[model samples]
Target: MRRMKVEQAAQVIDRPVYKAALIDFLYQLADDELFLGHRDSEWLGLAPDIEEDVAFSSIAQDEVGHATLFYHLLSELGEGKADDLAYSRPAAVRRNARLVERANGDWAYTIVRHLVYDIFEDVRLEALASSSYAPLAHGAVKIRREERYHLLHMETWFTRLGQAGGEAKARVERAVAAVWDDLGDLFSLGVHEAHIVAEGILPVARDELVQRWEARMKPLFEAAQLAWPGAPHPAKEDGRLGQHSADLDALLETMGEVYRIDPHARW
Candidate 1:
């Protein structure tokens, strides 16, 4: 079946369902990156090594940059100004998965969590790269290019830490379990999934994305000499529907404080 193509913001404006789905979908992408970037940034001064500190800082910048890209798309669709969209939304309105909002626990936890997320992102971008929505497809191509490097970096850490023996291996295994337990509805397409798929804004459904993620992770688990956790359970709270936790509220307060303080400031 051929999906309808939406080439411009003008095109989206005329289609109510597609427009609404796109807006919801963009929020999911933007909010996930915004909070995940903040989490990654917290590692800036805290990573065990100076190299990792610099690396995480760069990754944090990239994630936030990616979020702004999505926010810009939402702004084009009249959601609001990009900065306003990024900084002003309350936690109850956010659409990020729970995984992105969790605190960074240990280096082991961070590495496992990052690798799992990067794989999911890679699978998602691969699907989005072919989206019938032209603007989104173009952006996915560029963003996926950068994300692949991130995946590779996390994979390196995952394997090295796992193979280092004793405490490193134990911690890696423990972190993997913790991350696995937290993986709930991480790839959900939200309430607008059917509309998004019908318009070809996102090519795959949530289930396929999760399946791809699991397939990608299996070998990484084997290479790392760790047991693969089975499929994740559906979360009780659906973040896609704007349900989040206490952590998200605190993170948002900090992320938007500067903007809240000086709404008129250029930056």
Candidate 2:
């Protein structure tokens, strides 16, 4: 597909159905990063090791930055200011996958979670890097560079923890079990999945992305000596459709607290 500027794409997708699909797609991308970044930042002063603390902090910042970029793109489409779009939305309206919205658990949980999420993000961004929406494609190229490091960092920890052959391995296994069920919806394209594909906003099919994600993780799981948690069950409520857990509600309360106190304050 030939790349087109946002304005050019807008002209082509003048119909409401196409426009709405594009917006929904962008929201899913932006919300995932924003929520996960917030979750990751929870480890700022709490990571097990100082180096990991610093590394995770940096990764968190990058995820937030990526969210900001996507939000800005949405703003260009007349959504609202990026900050308002990000902070003012209720949890019921957020489109991040359940995997990202769930609270960070133990260090092993965090490692496994990051491993799973980073692989998905890597695949998603690779697909987006060639998106017909030119600006998003450009942004994807930049974000994927930083994301590569995140994948490496998680993989290193994943392998080490798996090979440690003690409590660490057991903990990671437990974490995997806890999150496995919710993994099914991670690649869901929501209600307008077909329209989004037809409009060229998502260059790759959702199923293909899932396949790539699994392929990428298979070797990592093996090297880590971890069993692949087979076939995830459908989540009772998926975030793509704006259904979320109480954990997301709590997270939004904290995340938007400062903004709500004074939405106009410059900071």
- How well does model 2 score by local distance difference test? 0.87
Residues 93-181, model 1: lDDT tens digits: 88998888888889999899889888988998999998988888989999999998899999999999998879999999899888877
My TM-score estimates for the predictions, one after another, are 0.97, 0.95
Q: Which sections of candidate 2 miss by over 4 Å?
A: 1-13
Q: Which stretches of candidate 1 lie over 4 Å from their true place?
A: none
Please, what is the whole-model Cα lDDT of each candidate in the order they appear? 0.88, 0.87
Pairs that collide in candidate 2 are: none
lDDT tens digits by residue: candidate 2, 190-245:
88899787677888898788889889988998999988887567667778998888
